[model samples]
Target chain A: MIEAIGVSKRYGETVVVDGVTLRLPRGGVTAIIGPNGAGKSSLLSMIARLLPMSAGQVRVDGLDVARTPGAVLAKRLSILRQDNHLPARLTVRDLVAFGRYPHSGGRPTREDAAHVERALRYLALEGLAERFLDELSGGQRQRAFVAMVLAQDTDYVLLDEPLNSLDMQHAVAMMRLVRRAAEELGKTVVLVLHDLNFASCHADHIVAMRDGRVLMQGSPAAIMTPEAIAAIYDVEATVHEIGGRLIAAYFA
Target chain B: MTAARDPRLVLAVLGALALGSAALFMTWGVNGAWGFALPFRAAKLATMLLVAHAVAVSTVLFQTATGNRILTPAVMGFDQLYVLVQTVLVFALGASAFAGLDRRLLFAGEVAAMIAFSFLLHAALFGGARRSLHLLVLGGVVLGVLFRSLAGFLQRIIDPNEFAFLQDRFFASFNSPHHGLLAIAAAMALAASLLGWRALRRWDVLSLGREVSITLGLDHRREVTRILVMVAMLVSVSTALVGPVTFLGLLVANLAHAVMPSFRHAHLLPAAFLLAVICLAGGQAVLEHGFGFDTSLRVIIDFLGGILFIALLVRGKVR
Candidate 1:
């Protein structure tokens, strides 16, 4: 379970994330979706402890993110930011192996190697495991990063804009992987996504944020209403239950 | 694809090369009495090894922390600051009083000041929700220019004899090893290596950048600060001992990275250290035997290293 209590982030005069209190459900896929500058990424980063909060506190499984040591939280939680630029030359497997750093401290044990292999297989990147990151396409590189985060084997996974640079096919595949992580692995997966239809079809719960605050939160069926979609994003969209899944058609 | 050469094998080969150069430098053309030649050569060898290790370790850690290969601790104006400190001492107290000051004490003071400068600069530039490394580097470059100009101004106004003494004190001289200061340099260098070993594994992870490193459970800011302090220690040790061999670190560090395909610092550090040793010891040998001491080894190193730096810039890999 992840809980944010009156959390806020202020950069000088700009309040990026306003004070908000919420508890995210465990063992489910929760997607935070909002328009640009909606503070979705900022909120997710605060919960992951990747960004410092200017006010209030965040707790993960009864551990205060502000007070707990990073090493301790690392074992139970992991996060992937949007952009990852490595200065050193690293192959895909080499990078995935680093996901076990909290446990191995750079010395990969046999068990850590198993995790790396499993992650590579899960992302369907076994063929490219030996390929350098610079040699891969944007989508493949994005999957490689996602593979690293999954190899962390944390109960709570937070990703900020994981779908960026990914094509539609890869995007759907990524959402399915996130669902599998929640269902099969029993992990709580939280991600900030911009694509409304993808969030509606894949997420168990949808969090709509706007102007640094949560505008609405509920099941996809509840939040998929036309007014709610318009309230979140200033666009006219029709929500239709197709094959028992809420699909938003904002095109046209 | 050509299989990558095992970094360990490269490390071994470089180690052998470093040793070969060290041996050649130690005994190359010693026609004098064995007793007299051995101690003199040994002292110089010890100083060279200390400076090489300092330059290697400091450059590796600084580049890791900054995540850029082009910026060494020298860019922070440490070498120039060292010269400025020496100049002010000579200008204020004269050569007699400066010479009378214990060399070990002066060396320790310089190291302390260098460490203090890193801490102060980091604290002042790294806060306010802005960990802008660009700002830090810009500030450093600006301050480096300022320090150089101030040192130049002081040099012009000082007495001619004092100026000459300061010049002698400033440029690195490989031929002369102040044997009295070797023990102090060795002790400090050893302490630095111990701490460096403890943080060795973390350096590879650090190269992944701050967000990923923190997500991997490292206190990135704190760890970077620690590495910078160690870097400061090393820069101070080498600069104080040999009057600041500015380009040696850049030359050897990049060479190590280019030669080894591995990303592990454990492998990279040794390769870099051996490269430094080979460059300095081998160059010293060539300067002694081939050139017959007609030219300074520092000039040769700076000349090669400067060209390499410009090449790296032109290649557009630094960004």
Candidate 2:
């Protein structure tokens, strides 16, 4: 479980994430939906300890995120940020193998290699494992990043804008992978998503943010209503239930 | 991606070539007394090898910390800071007093000052703001400009004879080295390399960049500070021993990356060291024996290195 108590981020007089307090339960896919400048990424980064919180405390499984050693925290939690400017020369396998760094400390053993191989296979990157990151397509490279995070074997995964550059097919595939990771592997996953329909259809729980505060939080069926959507995004979007899944048509 | 060459084979070839150059440098033009001439040549040989190791390792480490192949310690003004120290000594003590001071004391003072400067710079820039690596580089470049201008102003105001003496010390020279200074430098470089040797794997991860390194559980700030101190010691060693060779590190490090083409520092570090050895020893042998000291080794190296720098820029290989 991750808990943020009065979390806030400020730059001088401007507050990017202002006084956000929320509890995120363990074991499921939780999607954070918000508009631009809604502080979705900032909140997630603070939770991951990538960004320092201004006036709040974040604890993961009773361990203060800021006080805990990175090595200890890395074993329990892992994060993959969007726009990873990595070296293009690293092979998919080499990149994924780094996921075991906290455990093996760069000296990989047989078991570490097995974990790397499983990650590659799980991401369907077995054929492209030997290929360099620069040689792969955008979707394949995105999958490679996911494979690396998966190989970390952390119980909680934080992904910031994981579907940023992926196409429709790849985006859906990534969402499915996130769901499987939560349901099958019993890992807790948090994602900052842009598409309302994707978040509504895939996420087990949804948290809506506007102006750095949680506008609403509940199951998709409750948060996907027209009133909630208007209040959160300030757009009058009709919500339709098709195939027993609440899908919001916010584009039109 | 193209087929990758085996790093071991490349390293072996570089090691052999470096050894061959050293052998050739020692053997050529030994008509004088064997006992008298051998130690003299050996001193010069040891000096070249030490400078090669210090400059190459420091450059590679600096690039790793900065996450770019283009920026070396020399480019960051480390060598310029050494020059400033030398200029200040001459300006304060006058020519005779400066020359009369104990060379060992002077070397120690220069090295200590450089390390102190690096620590101050590291703390001031990286302490509170958590400034990015590029910002630090920009600060270094600005500081380099300040140091160069100050040194130049001092040279202009000093006596012409003193200026002549100072000018001679500015350019790098491998022809003659102080035996005492060479011994101290070798010990220091050896110590730094030992520290570097244990952290070779960590360096490989660090080269990935700051965010990735931190996410991998490395204390990025602490690691970068340690690497900077090592770089300061190294830059001081080479610059104090043979003066400043600005482009040698850039040339050697880029060549090492090109040849090894692996992210692993285990292969990259030795490859850069060996390549530096080859460039210095082999180039010195050719210039000393073949050209009869008609050309300066620093001139030739900077010429080739400058050209390579421009080529890298044209190819957009800064990353």
Candidate 3:
């Protein structure tokens, strides 16, 4: 279980993440959806220890993230940010193989090689394994990064805007991959997402934030109401129940 | 790729070139009696190889830490700092004081100052915030200008005779090895290289970017800081020994990358060092014998290296 207590992040005069305290349970997919500048990414960064919180503490399992050694936390939890620009040339295999760095450093053992192979196959990147990351298409690169995080073999995975550059087909496929990782692998997955319908259709729990505070948190059936959607986005979103899934239509 | 076209083969060729140059450097000063000439030339050869290794390794590490190809250790005002120290010594103690001062002490003082300045600069610029590479480079430029202006001001205030002595100190010369300082420099370089070897694997991961390195459990901030300190020490040693060859590092490191396309630091570091050795040793040999050039070898290196730097920038390969 990952827990944040009174997490707050302020930049100069503005408070980006205002006193957010929440618990993300184990072995499920939790999607954080918010409008622009809603502090969704800031909150995730704090939880992952990528950003220092102005005031708060985060605990993963029994270890305090702030006090824990980086390598230790890295072994248990992994995070992939939205934008990753590497300055050097690295192939997809090289990038994914780095996932085992905490365990093997740089020298790959037979076991580490097995993990890399499995992750490459899992992401359908076997054909592009040797291809440089810069040469791959946007969606392919996105999957390659995801495969790297998956190869880390962490129990808890935090991804910020994982589907940013992905097309519809790839986005749906990526979501299914997240779902399978949570369900079959028994790993806890937390992600910040923009598309409300995608979050509603796939997430086991929905966390809606507005202006740095949690507006609502519940199952999709409870948080997908017109009143809840309007309160969170400040715009009219018609919530429709189709195929037993609550889909929010905000396009119109 | 086949073994014939393998990039490793290119690295092997460069290594051979470095070795051949070392051999040439050792024998270049051989004269009527082999006994006396060989030791004198061998000392110079050792100094050249050490300085070459120091500059090449530091520049490559600096580029990796900054995540940019165009920046070198000189940009951080390290060489300018050395100049400032020399000028200050002349101003305070007079030209005659330089003859009495221990060369090793002077070298130590200069290196210490450079390392301290670098630490202070990095702390001020990057403390508690994300640092942009552009901003860091800009800060370096500003610092370089400030140090150079200060040194120039001191130079103006000194007597004409003292000014002449200071001027001689500024231009790079291969005639003097300062054997007293060589042992200390070699020891420090060896220690830094060992630490670097321990961190080599993580360095490859580090070049991938901060996010990936952090995700892989490497302490990105601590690791970068350590590398910067090592780079500062190495740069100080090289600049103190041979004055400053600003473009030699940029030329060699880029050549290494062009020749060996591997991202692995294990290969890249050796290739870069070998490239530097070949450039420095071979250029010195040619300047002394092949061309019979009476000028300092630094002039030849700077000329070629400056042109290569411009070409690299024009090709847009330095991003």
Against the true structure, whose TM-score is highest? 1
lDDT of predicted model 2: 0.87
Give per-residue CA lDDT, model 2, range B169-285, as digits (tens): 765479866556777788788777777667888887787677667777777777787799889889988987798787999999999988885778888889999999999999999
Identify the candidate with maximal DockQ: 1
Q: Model 3: share of native contacts present?
A: 0.70
Model 1: per-residue Cα lDDT over B185-242, one tens digit each: 8888888888767887788889998889989999887789888878877887787678
Give the alpha carbon lDDT tens digit for every residue of B213-279 in model 3. 8778889888888888788779767766667777788888888776776787887888899998898
Estimate the TM-score of every prediction.
Answer: 0.93, 0.93, 0.93
Score candidate 1 by lDDT.
0.86
Question: Between which residue pairs do clashes occur in model 1?
Answer: none
Provide the TM-score of chain B versus the true chain B for each model in turn: 0.89, 0.88, 0.86
Q: Evaluated with lDDT, which candidate comes out highest?
A: 2
Query: Which 10 residues in a row give candidate 3 chain B its minimum summed lDDT?
Result: B1-10
Model 2 earns a TM-score of: 0.93
DockQ of each: 0.75, 0.63, 0.64
Measured over the true interface residues after superposition, the C-alpha RMSD of each candidate is 1.3, 1.5, 2.0
As for candidate 3, its interface RMSD to one decimal place is 2.0
lDDT of 2 by residue, A1-252 (tens): 999999999988989898998999899999999899999999998998888889899999999988999888889888889867666568899999999998999999999999999999889999998898888888898899899899989999999999999999899999999999998889999999999999998999999999988988999999999999999989999988899988888787
